[model samples]
Target chain A: MQETPRIRMLLGLADDALIHGHRLSEWTGHAPTLEEELALANIALDLIGQARALYQATGLPEDDLAYLRDPHQFRNVLIAELPNGDFAFTIARLLLVATAADLAWRDAATSDDSDLPAIAAMARNEIAYHIRHAADWLIRLGDGTEESHRRSQNALDALWPYTGELTVGIDRSAWLGAIEAVLERATLTHPADGWMQGGGRDGRHTEHLGHLLAEMQILPRSHPGATW
Target chain B: MTNTPLWEVFVRARNGLAHKHVGSVHAADATMALQAARDVYTRRGEGLSLWVVPSNAIVASDPTDREMLFEPTGSKIYRHPTFYEVPEEVGHM
Candidate 1:
């Protein structure tokens, strides 16, 4: 069957959620506090839920799509696959990605495609909370003590370059404006536009994604054709 | 951090119901406390609403004063709903 642009878009969104959700789940036991650990894990579960719905919409078994796909077949943007560095880095990355996702899902909720719009509508409420959670952390960490402020600023600067890839082929003004407003309130500086990294949407990714996929795919691959 | 305050959580299971104390979580502020409550106490779809208040805000009668505070109610059998009998035709009432 010929794939529609809608299917491609759905795949991109799903892959982004799946990969980032995996990274977020990695913090299950290691977060700064028990409350934070639960919060991050909850957010991770929400993303994975979104991914499962998107995968099901494609008329394939969700597990097959998630666990059997090749690395190059993924369509998530570059930002979603980056390493979770410090807590500051994770917050910075989430703030940027969740903001973009909130905008994208808000638009997708009204899309002409049947499954995409319904899935988007169902997922929008969850994404809204994710955005708020990330935004709250960003503001707190950025405006916090001297060490926190320094670390947050560094994370923002380091991750800023990858964000441009998210803006491609989408109306970026809303995303940029939302991010600017948060940065302003948080007292964090936005990096000036310069050289921007690209290519994850085209199946080219950093080494981090490959390592992540290896761990995630191990169980399913080791037990091919086995069902619980 | 240990310095973070503890907040007691209450969850309302449905509309027209009172929020009942469920558990406690630690957070730096009310906003984080609310988020923590939603994440911890409501994960099983157990709530229609949530409230988180700082633990210190609550004033409880001393445990040593249990007899003074609560023991008297136990002996008041007349206060029990079963103490009165309704005709069978009254059914639910």
Candidate 2:
């Protein structure tokens, strides 16, 4: 409820995980295969778990923060709110965000000996797995077939602009290098950097966040204090 | 579904423990099989290590040979380690 520099940082982390996890959850019943269905769901759960911990660290009720926030109140980066395009697109998106999340959480865990650091320590391990899963898929799709290569490359280029917002407290060069190595291994060309889009960090966001929140918040808003 | 082969999974609960057969996962390669096994079988820290083998690679005993192959072994009680005298210090093998 109260805004502080530290709380805003926590919100940024929580919102990114929450929105990205929500987007991933959309693939629950529709992933390409049974193994991928389970894999994607597990990754989504890990991300939501990370969001829960970060929100809890803010000393606000995590549910209230999640379900009661307005569209403008969300601080998740723009790339996270984008729709899951195709299988290759989702994997590409995962590769990008998971890499950033892994680095960000690692830095946070090592930054201080506080409650946020403890949450970050646990989150860092889970996100390490996310990074590996995404990287593995990126390679498979990027190098697998002619169609897959085109799709994977397109996904990276499309999502590249929104990544500019992720570097507020993150190391841009480290993130870029890590991503570049994976892209190189995947045999996917790196998109040229250009006019980087931003905003969600300062509460400005794409139109998608409103629709996402509308669906995500409806049950809580409609029912108020009711619980099963 | 397109040539993604099935692999049988085995997971070790901890160091010094055997990797018991867990289940199967479908993957295009050995590396993906391991990742799939980790995702499907070991979500709750249930394993210290994992192994995935192509399901087709495993050779299984024929059910019809059970009596011929295993019946004699059932009668061979002398193979049991119970024949050895245990020193008290050795304790609980």
Residue B60 in model 2: shift from native, Å?
Answer: 1.3
Which candidate number would show the highest TM-score if scored against the true structure?
A: 1
TM-score of each: 0.96, 0.92
lDDT of 1 at A185: 78
In angstroms, the error of model 2 at A60 is 1.1
Q: How many backbone clashes does candidate 1 have?
A: 0
Model 2 residue B84 CA deviation (Å) reads: 11
Off by over 4 Å in 1: A1-4
What digit string (tens of lDDT, one per residue) describes model 1 on residues A1-228? 335776677788999999999999999889998888888899899999999999888887789888988888888988888888899999889889988888788778777876888888878898888888888888988888999899999999999899888877666888889988888878999889889998888889988999999999999999997877
What C-alpha lDDT, on a 0 to 100 scale, does residue B61 get in candidate 1?
81
Q: Which candidate gets the maximum DockQ versus the true structure?
A: 1
TM-score of candidate 1 chain A against the true chain A: 0.96
